[model samples]
Target chain A: MPEAVRSALAIAGKDLRLEFRTRTGLLSAFVFAVLTLLVFNFSRDQSLISTTDLAPSALWITVAFGAVVAMNRAFIIEKEQGAIDALLLAPVPRGAIYWGKFLANLAFVGLVEALTLPLFVLFFNVPLGPALPGVVLTLVLATIGFVAVGTILSAMVVRTRFAELMLPVLILPFMVPPLIGAVQVTARLLGGRPLTEVLGWLRLLGTYDVVFVTLCTLAFSAVVDE
Target chain B: MPPEAPLLEARGITRAFGAQRALRGVDLRLGPGEAVAVAGPNGAGKTTLLRILAGLMRPTTGEVRLADGRTPRDPAARRRVGLLSHQSFLYDDLTARENLHFTGRLYGLGDLAARASRALEEAGLAARADDPVRQLSRGMLQRVAIARALLHEPDILLLDEPFTGLDVPSAARLRGFLAAQRAAGRGLVIVTHHLAEAWGFATHVGVLARGQWAQLGPRPASLEEFLAGYQELVDA
Candidate 1:
């Protein structure tokens, strides 16, 4: 691997270890995801909206909010002891630091999705037998798009007084594109629609991922620079 | 780069925050085997200057450069500078050894395990290497931060109040360590409030007041002379 990638991976690994050791951030996100799912399960009028109809929206909504919770911790850890300055002083490209945080957030959000999926199925009674692959693909692509945008926004608000509140406010707008894409693709997939029909949404999600990832990676240096 | 070139140089460096200026037209040159101790009152911009020198912050109007004419913005050039700020720059959950290992990885240094081990031993934290940083005392945390700063072996070191939390023994050890660094031809710019800390090691001593150097020159011949000079500048 190239040195930058190696450094990025090292950072990601370190972040993962810290998360696993403390478990506070991840646990809170997981609990939030579960609570969101429970609220959706209990409040919906089952006669009007079948489990199939509610599954996609419920899952995507949980993910969108859960992601905000997870990404909020991304830069908060660095801010704790002012570790971000040390990271900034290192002889590595700024893009590497951006990618490191991006990848780490990707894993964090991905794990939340993974843990939430089974509960989502149990609560909604949604059969994901044939559409599991499509659902997984939608999850990955949409996650990349939102996490790409979220990583940079997290860094931007980390220095602010109201970072915790500011993150969801700034991030929810950007999360719209991918959340809509994921819900559309997932709803169609679960409704037994053909794969051919969901291709447009997938393409939109792919484009969003590529465009935002590149733009955010480029903007990160300026965001973190003093 | 010529052998005689200053290891670290800054010219006309100024930084401002909105309506307030923190530093203005400050300049410094640090040559190999030389140490400069910068003393100043509160709000003198000593920390700001150190941050700019460490490349953690860019000056609003001036520039800092390395021996080869490369600015701190260059990744390669940044590798030659080490910084120890007031913040420990350590994760509370990680152990001391892990912190060193992580820093080594950031610098792309090889033999991380050995290097971290040696650094822990040198800081007298080998027994506590595996303990989480949150469990260490303030003095121990400072020691770990110092070790982390020096682990990569940079050519120039910019330390901001490095002795803040150190005990008497640790402070003496740090002074000895810095003297050894000077003996090894490394350049140092140490920022401190106490003049005694810089007494024997600093080849030059300067005072910063209101964001500019009030007085900057060679070390006075005696402690009394240096104290008198420092008092004169602060009083002015």
Candidate 2:
């Protein structure tokens, strides 16, 4: 493996180990996701809005907010005891550090989504017979866009006075494009529309992922150092 | 590289935070095997200077360069420097051994397990290696942080208040370890308020007052002599 990749993997491993050991961020995020799903399941009357219509919005909403909760802890770990400085001072590339954090956030958000999907299905009675793969692809593609943006934004806001409040404020606006794309694709997939019908949204999500990931990686050093 | 080129150099480094200037036109040069100790009152920019040299923060003005002509901002050049600040820079949930192993991997060191074990043994924390850092005492955490900084054995080491949390025995061990590092041709820059601690190993001494050097030069002949000079400079 390339040295940079190796360093990034090491960082991701460290983060995962810390997450499992403390179970602080992941647990909170999971609980929040479950609660959001429950609220959506109960707040609406099935007689007015059908489960099929609400499922897409509910799932994406739960995932987006839950993701913010999870990504909030990404830089907080480094800020604790100022470990970020040591990570910055290492021989690894600055992009590697960003990539490491991004990878870890991706995993955390992905895991939360995985846990929520089953509960979402159970609570809302959404059908998943043939649309499972499409839904998964939509989740992955949309996640890459927001998580990429969130990783860097987390680093930027970590030093701010009200980081927890600051993160969602800054990240929510950026989440719009990808979230809309995700919701549209998910709604189509759940409505039994063929995958070909959602290709435009998928392409938009793919393009967003590429652009934001590259921009975030390139801008990470400036965000952390300055 | 030139035979006598300094391991690190800073020219007129001035760092300002908005309207408040923390450092003013500071100059420093550290050659191989040499140790420079910087002493200053609180808020005198001692840590700021160290951070700038470590490439953790960029100076508002001026430049810092490694012997190889690249700035410390260069990743390859950064590998040649290690910094131990007041914070342990360790994850509290990770064991001492795991922390060392993680650092070793970041530095791309070969034989990570062996290096981590050796570092744990050196810190005298081999017995407590498996315990999470949150379970360790302040002094033990400091020792682990010190071990992490020295794990890769960088050419230049930067320490800020290294002796703050150390016990007497650990302090003495650190002094001995620093002397051995000097003997091995590694350069070091230490920031401390304690005159004796700086006097113990610094071949050169600098007194900083209000972001500028009040006095900076070779070590005085004796601790008493350096103390007199230091007091006079701060008094002025």
Candidate 3:
């Protein structure tokens, strides 16, 4: 394996181990997501409004908010323990550090989304049989986009006095493009729209993921450099 | 004959934060088997200088180079230097052994488990290796921090107020450990306010005032003489 990949995996593994030990961040985000799904389920009557129509927006909103909660804790731990300095002092490349944190956050947010998916299906009463594959693809792409920007913004705000307040403010604006793309694609998949019809939204999501991931990776070194 | 390049050299380092200058053309040279103690008043740019030397921060104007002529900014050069700052740079949730192992992995060291175990023993924390860092006392934390810094066995060690929060016995143990490192020919730069303690170990001493080196040279013959000189320099 390449040194960069090895280093990244090491960091991701360490983060997962710590998370496994405490489960504080994961548990909080999971509970919040479940509650968000429940609130959406109870708000509307299924007879008047179709479950499919509401499922896309509800699922996306749950993911976006839950991701914010998870990413907010990503660098806060490092800053609190001064582990960021130790990381900086190491010979590892800055991009490795960013990717490591990105991978860990990706897994965390992905887990929350996965756990919430079953609840979403049960609450909305939507048949995800053939649409499951498309929904999974859309979720992965959208997650990459959400976590890419969320990871960088988390690092930026971790040192500030009002870090918790600052994360949503800094990330929500950049999040709009990806969130919109994700919702449209998800809605199309749930509605069983032809793939050709939703190709534009898929492209939008792909472009957003590629562009932001590259941009954030390049910009991370500057963010962490004192 | 030209002087051989020191193990580490800082040439004309100057740093400023907006209108305030923290380091003004500060220069230093460190070689193996030498221990330099840097003493300074508050806000004398001690921390800034150490950070620059460690390549954690860039100087406004200057450069740091390793003995092999690699710039401090180079990852290869950075790998050769160890730094222990005021912040322990430790993960409170992780055990001492785990923290050291984590650092070893970051450095890509082979045989990490054995190395971490050795470091744990060296720090006198072998019995508590599995305990989380947050559970440890300040002195124990400092000891673990030292272990973390030395885990990679870097050629030079840069320490900032390492004695802070250490109990008397811990402090003595640390001094002895550092002395051993020096004896083994590792370069050391220690920043402290405890003149007496510093004098006991330093072969050379420096004083900084207002972001400049007020006086830097060999250690004075006695603490009284060093104090008198330090007072006059700060006053002047």
Candidate 1 residue-wise lDDT, B1-236, digit = tens: 65688998999999999989999899999999999999989999999999999888989998999999999778999899999999999999999999999999989999999999999998999999999999999999999999999999999999989899999999999999999999999999999988798777999988999899998888887977777667679768
Instruction: Write candidate 1's Cα lDDT for A1-226 as tens digits.
Output: 8889988998898899999999877899999999999999999999998988889999999999999999999999999989999999999899999999999999999999999999998998888888999999999999999999999999999999999999999999999989999999999999999888999999999999999999999999999999
Query: Ten residues in a row with the worst lDDT in model 3 chain B?
Result: B195-204
Error of 2 at A223 (Å): 0.7
Q: Alpha-carbon error at B63 in model 2, in Å? A: 1.1
What is candidate 2's CA lDDT for residue B152?
Answer: 95
- In order, the Cα lDDT scores of the candidates are 0.93, 0.93, 0.89
TM value for model 2: 0.98
How would you encode candidate 3's per-residue C-alpha lDDT over B79-170 as one tens digit per residue? Answer: 89999998899988889988898899889999999999998998889999999999999989998998999899998999999998888887
Going through the candidates in order, state the TM-score of chain A alone for each one. Answer: 0.99, 0.99, 0.97
* Cα lDDT, model 3, residue B152: 92
Q: Once model 1 is optimally superposed onto the true structure by TM-score, how far is the C-alpha of residue A183 displaced, in angstroms?
A: 0.9
Once fitted onto the true fold, the runs of candidate 1 whose alpha carbons sit more than 4 angstroms away are: B1-3
